[model samples]
Target: MSATTYDRLVEIVTKLHDAPEDRISPDVTFAQLDVDSLTMVEISMRIERELDVHIDDNELEADLTLDATTKLIDAKLAA
Candidate 1:
């Protein structure tokens, strides 16, 4: 993924987690960020609304890390 895509992921994750942008990393897990299922769903919805991309539950489950999530968003944007 491009650096901008990764940066966008970090921004979105930070917003969802209510944490500092620097606190989120590619290696960090969502669980470690104390993000619950409902929050995850809300985040997904926000991404869809903001980015105009659809991300299903399975994709969210498969892409747990920030890097993976960024890649997924990049792919959707490309598509």
Candidate 2:
């Protein structure tokens, strides 16, 4: 949606992958980033801490792309 969300997702993805921000994209999958289950959990925890939001397991499982994850986070923030 917003560039801010996209930027944040890129930042998080970059942090997780240790890649340049430009390398991360909305279409990229978590698996493609070489992120494992434990890493995903860690990412979730970081997101919760940074964004002040709670993400359910189901939601985490369902969001497969960076864009989707950003959307989910946006929706939760809206709620």
Q: Model 2, stretches more than 4 Å misplaced?
A: 1-3, 20-22
lDDT of each: 0.77, 0.74
> Where's the lowest-lDDT run of ten residues in candidate 2?
14-23
Error of 1 at 46 (Å): 1.0
Candidate 1 residue 38 Cα shift, in angstroms, is 0.6
Tens digits of per-residue lDDT for model 1, 1-79: 5448777667676777786656678877777677888888887887788777899977786238877787889899998
* Clash list (residue pairs), candidate 1: none
TM-score of 1: 0.79
The best candidate by lDDT is 1
